[model samples]
Target: MEKPAELQAANYDLVARDTKSVGAYVKSGAPYVWVTAAAISVAFIITVALLLLTAARGLPHFWPADLVQATYKEPGKEQQHLLAEIRSSEEVTTARLLNAGLPVDEKQPLYDRLLLKIANRDLGGVDFRYVLSDWLVERSQPKDATVLERMEWGNFHGFVVALKEGDKVVASGEEAWKGYQERQDRVNDLRGKVRDIEKGKIGAVNYDLERLRLQQRRLELDGKTPERNAADFAAIEAKRKSENEKYEVLRTELDQLNAEMGRDALVMKTVDGQEVTLPLSKLIQGYRPNDMGLFPKIGFFLGAIWHFVSEEPREANTEGGIFPAIFGTVMMVMIMSVIVTPFGILAALYLREYAKQGPLTQAIRIAVNNLAGVPSIVFGMFGLGFFVYFVGANIDKALYQEGLPSPTFGTPGILWASLTLALLTLPVVIVATEEGLARIPRSIREASLALGATKAETLWKVVLPMASPAMMTGLILAIARAAGEVAPLMLVGVVKLAPSLPLDGNVPFVHFERKFMHLGFHIYDVGFQSPNVEAARPLVYATAFLLVLVILLLNLSAIRIRNKLRERYKALEH
Candidate 1:
C-alpha cells in the first residue's frame, strides 16, 4: 500500500482532472443549450397540463351524470334525504370541519366532503350544498328521478307528478312522463314559432317604424315640411300606416302563440315529498339522467354542447348558448384585420421604400415600438375619447343629425372596437411587413423595372406578393392578441348580452355601430361577475377553453395561408 500523503496526492490529481472537465464543458456552452431545451420542454408540459386541467373541470359538466339519492345521518341531527348530482369531492381536516359547525370527532385527523348540486333554486333557494361523506348512507340512483332545465331558475331535480292542460290533469305519475314526452316536440315547435314572430316579423315591423320616424325627422331637419314636400310626407305617412297594420297582425299572432304556450303545466314532486307546479313555458327540457345508457348520455352531451354554442343566453348569462358572443368575436377580428392590413402595409411601404433613412424615421420606429408596450386599457380610453366622442360625434352631427341626441355612431360600437384593435396591432404589422420588404432582393425590383414595368407595378406585383407571407404572420399574431382581449373590448364595444346581431338581412348588412357580445368578455363576465360562483365555475373554465380554441383556429388558418404564400414565392428567392 502507498503512504497516506501519496494517496492524498493521487486524490487531488483526480479532483483536478474532474474540475478541468467541468470547466471545458461550461466553456463549450453545452449547459446553456441543455438549460434552454429543458426550459422549453417544461413550458410545453405546463401549458398542456393546464389545458388538461381546464378540460377536466369543464367538459365533464355536460356528460349527464347520474342523479344520486342518499340518506344522511349527521351526529345529533335527524335523518334527511338528498337528491343531487355529485359535483365534486375534497378531503378536510377534522378541525376545519368542526369550525364549519359540523360534528366531527376530535380523534379523526381527516374527513371527506362532497359537493352536491341540489339545483332546486326556487324551493331550496340554493343550487349547491356540501355534505360530510362519512354521514351519507343508502346511496343509489333512482330511474324515476327527473332533472328539469329551466329558463329562469337554475334547474329542478325531482320526480314527475302530473301533466295538466289548464285545470284538467291530462296524465299522472308514470303516465305523466310519457305524456310529457309525447307533447315535448309540439311544445318546442310552438316555442319556436313564438320566438320567430317576436324576433323576426315583429322585429322587422318595428325596425321599419323606427326608420320612418327617422326619415320624418330628417325631412324636418332639411326644412322639407308637409307644405313644402307633400308627396314625401304623404309617402311617409302611408308607409307608417302599412307598418302599423303589419305590427297589429304580428301582435295578434304573438298573443295567440303565447296563450297556447301557457296552456300546459308540469307538476314535480321533490325528494322530500313536496309537490310544485312549473309552467311548461318556463321549462326548456327534462330528462332522467340516472336512467340514460352510455350512447344516450353521449348523445345528450353532444346536444348540450350544440345548445351552448348555438343558443342565446338566458338566466343572467349562466344558461343557454353563446352564439352571439362567438359571432361578435369573429366579426371584430375580421374587421380589425381588414382595417389594419391596408394602414400597416402602407406605413411599412413608406418607411422601407420611400422615406429617407434619417433620424426622423428612426424616431418614428421607436415611437411605434413604444406603443406596443403601452397597456391595452390606455388604448381603449383613447378610442373612447377620440373615436367615440370626437370623430364619431362629428360624423353623427354631419350625416346623422336626425339621431343627434341619441348619438347613432357617437357611441362605443363594433366599428370603434375594430379600429381600436387595429391601432393596438399596427406596430406588429408594420415591423413584420418592413422585415419582409427588406428581405426582397434589390435585383428583383431592378429586373421588373428593366422589363418595362413601372416602380408602382413592380411593388404591387412583385414585392407585395413575396411579402404576403410575413403580412399573414403579423395578422396571425394580431388575431391571437385581439381575440383574447377582454378589457379593451369591455370599454369599446362588448356587452353582457346583445339583443340583436350586428349583421342581418336588413339594408347595410353589417351594422358597425352596434354593440356586441364577445367570447373574451363572456368569459370575464361568467367567471368574475356572476352571482352564483359555484354554478359559474365550470362555465368559466369552459368559456376560457373555448376562447383559446377560437384563437388557435384563427392562428392556424393564417399560418396555413402564410405557408402557401411562402411556397408560391420560393422560386423568386433564387
Candidate 2:
C-alpha cells in the first residue's frame, strides 16, 4: 500500500503543477486582456457611432419643406411662407440667412437673405410650390429691400431698381440706368421700324383699293360692253389680290419686329428690377427630402444605429433608408449560407472522418485551399458565364418561353448573384469546417463507437454540435465579405435603381429574376454616376458607413452565438 501511494506521487504532483500554472496565468494576464478588449471594442463602437451621426447631420439639408416655401399668389407677387415646425426661436435676419455658412462679396447686398441668396442663382430661381411650416415664418423676419443692395451671398452683388413698363433701362443704379436707356433706344428703334412697315403696308393697300374702285367706276360710267366691263372687273380684282399679298408680307415683317422687341422688353424688365446677385445655378437648386433639419437628422442617426444594433424589422419601401438593402443582403446571405453550409460540412466530414489521409484527400484539400485564394472577380466571371448564361438560359427557355426575348432567368438577377457568392464562399466554409472537425479528439469518436453508437449518430449528435459554432463563424465571415462586394454584383445583378424590390407583393412573389439595388451598388452609383456630385458625396459617406455597420452586426451576432455555444459545451470539457 505504501509503494502504491508513493507511485501515485508523480501524478498528483503533475496535476498540482498544472493547476498552479493556469491559476498564475489567469491572475497575471486576465485583467489586462479584458481591459484591452474593452478599450478596443469601445473605440470601435464609438468611431462607428460618430461616423453615422455625422452622416445623418450632413444629409438633413436635402429636404426643406419645413424651412420655407415660395408661392406665387398673383402673377407678379411671390411670397415666401416659412414653416413653423422646422424653425428655431432665434430670429434670423435675411442677410444672416444668406451668408449663414458662405462667404459674402462686398458688391452683392441681396446675398444676406437666404431666400434671396438662393433666388439669385439659376438653380434656386426655378419656381417652387411649397407650404412652409409656421416655425420658419416666425423665426424669419422680412429683410429690408434696401438692405439687399449691400449684402452679398457669395461673389455676386445685389441691387434694387424701379422699371417703367417695356423699358430696358434699370432705374436704380447709374450703370443699370445706362443699360436701361440703351435698351429703351433699341426698343424705340424697333417700334419705329415696325410702325413704319405697318404705315407703308396700309398706304399700299389703300392705293390698290382706290385704283380698283376707279377702274370699276370707269367701266360702268363709260357704258362699256359686258366683255369690257368683265375685263375691267378682273383687273380690279387682280390688283386688290396683289395689294392684299403685299400687306400680308408687311404685316408678317411687323410681327417679327414686335416679337424681337417683346423679348428684349422681358429681358429688361426681369433682369433690371431688384436684381439679386449670385451664381444663377447654385441659388436655384431645389431642396431635397433629406433636408429635414436637425431633428430629422438626429432621428435618422438613431434609426441607423438601432438598425445596426437590433434585429427590429424595417419599413419596406422608404426612400434613402437602408432597410431594403439590409433586407436584400440578409436574404441573400441566408440563402447562400443555407446552400453552402451542408455541402461544406459534408465535404469536411468525409475528408476528416471517413476518408483516409491519402494523396487524393490531400489533393482535394489543396484544391479547396486554392479555391479560397482565387480572385473573387474570377468567380464573378465564372458565375456570369455558367450560372447567368448557361443555367439561366435553360431555365428561361423552360419556364418563361412566353416572355421569349425578355430572357427572365437568362438575365442577371438576385438568385444568380447569391449562387455565385455561395460558390465563392464555399471554400472558406469547407476549410473552416474541416479545421474544426480535425480539432475534435479522436478518443471522443472511439468512445462513442465503443458505446454502441453508430458513425452517423456520433457525427450528428456529437461532432456536428461541437463543430456548429465554428461553421457559423465561417458563414458570418463569408456573408460580411459578400454583402460588401460590389464588383461581382455589378457584373451579375446590381442596378442604380430598381423600380421594384426583389421581394414585393405580386403573383408568385419574391422576384429573384429582376435586378435589385444594393448598398454597395448605391454608393457606387452616387459616387460615380449621379448628376450632382457635390450633393452625392455626403450620401456616399453615409451609405458606406451603413454598409460597414451591417457587416459588423452580422459578425457580432455570429460571435455571440459562438460564445453561447462555447458556454454550453464547457461542461463537456470538464
What CA RMSD would you report for each candidate?
A: 5.7, 23.2
Report the C-alpha lDDT of model 2 over 516-563, residue by residue, as the tens digit.
Answer: 767787777777876544435656676677677777888888789888
lDDT of 1 by residue, 508-530 (tens): 77899999999989988988899
> Could you tell me which 10 consecutive residues in candidate 1 have the lowest summed lDDT?
180-189
TM-score of 2: 0.53
If scored against the real structure, what TM-score would every candidate get? 0.93, 0.53
Which pairs of residues collide in model 1? none
What's the true lDDT of residue 286 in model 1? Answer: 91
Q: What local lDDT does model 1 show for residue 450? A: 96
